[model samples]
Target: MKAPRAVIFVSLFLLTFQSKAQTKFDHSIWDQILLLNVTKDGKVNYGGFMKDSSQLYEYFTLLSQNPPTEQWSKEEKLAYWINAYNAYTIKLVIDSYPISSIKDIKDPWNKKFFKINGEWYSLNDLEHKILRKMNDPRIHFAINCASFSCPVVWNRAYTGANVESALENQTKKFINDPLRNTITEDVVSVSKIFSWYKKDFKIDGKNVVDFINKYATTKIINQSKKGYKTYDWSLNE
Candidate 1:
């Protein structure tokens, strides 16, 4: 009788632990990895991430095992997808380490290499099919493409509670970042992302200039000459 009682106790403990683990997706591992490898200015240390690749693998395992479910809140789901996109992009670069540019890999964004809940996906799926469909233009700044011209990868993980603010902060940071966008009272020279996804910024009858002014430190005149800077494809390491 005592043996049976001990077995029941052990089983219950394991069940409880599993339940708690599945309740909320844990991003602490990824968060720690970012903190250790990424700079505040958004420069990544691929060598550092390579050395700590085991932790990245562990984080991916957790994400694959617990893909978002219907029970998750909208914010929770969005945050998960955003983090997954950025993290996997990092993994891609590290896997192809020593490459001068992500562009070196043919069809890099379209190559399906990661898995979630037993389903395969590529960066294009995450950026276009899922995230872009979500209808938040600020997402462009939150997801990094491992290029010098792309938005800096945040050094922190996005949690459901922080996703909204993070989006806002990232948009403002990227827009005002002189290196990324040159916004002035007379002219607006910005990233090619603005041209690529121009429709996304023109939400609610507003134009791209209006959207830039929303976060830009210096507002561009409506008639100001808008030009796109030449995109640098060098790896952001």
Candidate 2:
């Protein structure tokens, strides 16, 4: 009897743990994001984006409608908040209709732009505190700030499965483009991103050039050019 009872207890514990693990995330909407329009200029045209503001209002409703006492895994939390930030930022831009920059949609001092996970939050807080703090640097390029200086929006949506690879490609492509980097045998100059986020690229005793070199085109690596150009941030309109 004791042996049979022990087996039952073990079985029950394993089932409970599996349920907890699988329940950490709800990924049903991942496909919807991937389906949204992403353009080569890295613009999220979000055709009818203004009309889509209603969608965001509904999504935010889901997050705040429930208060979860159940602890979510870090990956689950990061993915949810990042998506929320991007969605809300885009909504903010479209809501104003003729906005020139994302800055135009936000408060100067950085206050609540929307409610998320039951808390009022700002784009600045979400990017700096949640994403960067989580060590996911690729997000810098993936989230569009409605500026031409920002990374080109890719053609696909960000899904949980491809999130890491998508971010890597964005960083590499943005850093290596001639518009973003200047390469020479003796010296190299690149976007302020190279300087500002050096830690992200310094994975193995490498600086920005070393990082860009991995994806730099032949012309870029030869350093046969005079100089690199700055990206015009005048809204991608």
Candidate 3:
């Protein structure tokens, strides 16, 4: 009798704990990245680019600690890491305050700017190790590098449930802006993101032209003669 009762108690405890965890956050945790906008004339002001790396880190750590016992058809871990990488990238820039560009950070050829669960890694590691491992291409839209060339920073937190839609919206918004995308009568120019993640697009049944045409404001779908514009790696500050 005692043994049976003890087993039931443990099961109930586990259920309660799982219930609490599930209720924690329907959405991904987010910290605002404070954007200090500086004008060419030397005027500077906070432009609402707040991002919370701590919240992102803590969430991913939880996912890392316990591989979800529940059946998860959606990508929680991969999406979380993507958000973490982007958030941390911003934090890295803010840590150095007044950086001219993300590349300004001196990452040794051997050591890039990425780390997993506390280990040092390069930006390559985050995309290749975590994101690519998940086999998802939408991630290209979610991870901003704090550069003029990178995707615009989203205002909302990306939760497991909404990450898919969030990324779709992000993709559409990013590729249509003339500042981000340039098209002329003869040639079409796109952001460097398409170049960096060219494989991600091609692997997912898309080419440079195929990818941009989905979001290009113009009805033209010119696959040939497509060119990548020179990127402004300068910081968005």
Candidate 4:
């Protein structure tokens, strides 16, 4: 015996409503937090954060308690995890305030400080298990590791609505920023991000140089030299 027509309609309405609610993850909180603590050049004011750590904790708590549901779009999920990863990295730095580098904490990436969806996650787990698995090589430029060599943290948050443009802009910025990547006419010196995650950049058979050239204003030629810059592990402050 099938359910009544009214019962079926009510069930459908409830399901749609639940899906909409679950997908409505607000990232404005993160935007406000970033605007307050981050500078125009992406430098984080940990000293200011030390005074008001409650907002950071609140953001983390929000992420922990409300993991994105399957109803969320791919862009939404990607933006959420990228923000989470960067936010947690900031938390780690703040927790160990006055440290010279993120490396100052033993196995910083492996520490299980992030609780999400009833499971604990470390920075490494989130980056490798989730973000990387998303198959978007551009993520390497979006998730900052709180190091000088890491991609510059955008002054604003990554919202699903703007994530695509944000990622594109950041990739271009990182490639063009002389401090992070130097693209000369004959030589392309780049951050270790490309060397470390070479395979990720090789999606669709594109090599590291091909990937870099996509955003490099100088446009590396076929025979141009490639060199990896020494990674600076010092705090990005």
Task: State the lDDT of candidate 3 residue by residue for 131-224, as single tens digits.
Answer: 7767667777777676777766665556667778878887887777677778766768878788877777775665767766766667445567
Query: Model 1: what TM-score?
Result: 0.89
Which residue segments of model 1 deviate by more than 4 Å?
Answer: 1-23
Ranking by TM-score: 4, 1, 3, 2
lDDT of 1 by residue, 153-211 (tens): 99999998899999999999999998888877666789999999999988899988889
- Which candidate would rank higher by lDDT, 2 or 3? 3
For model 2, how does the per-residue alpha-carbon lDDT over 125-183 read when each residue is reduced to its tens digit? 87777677776656677765666776775555454456677777887787756565656
- Model 3's alpha-carbon lDDT is 0.62
Q: Name the weakest run of 10 consecutive residues (lDDT summed) in model 3.
A: 41-50
Question: Which one wins by lDDT: 2 or 4?
Answer: 4
- Lowest lDDT sum, 10 consecutive residues, model 4, at 217-226
Over 75-127, each residue of candidate 4 has an lDDT whose tens digit, in order, gives 99999999999989988898888999999998999999868977989999989
Per-candidate Cα RMSD to the true structure, in Å, reads 4.1, 4.7, 5.2, 2.0
Q: What is candidate 3's TM-score against the reference?
A: 0.73
Point out where model 3 deviates above 4 Å. 5-73, 108-118, 203-206
Error of 4 at 200 (Å): 0.3
What overall lDDT goes with each candidate model? Answer: 0.90, 0.61, 0.62, 0.88
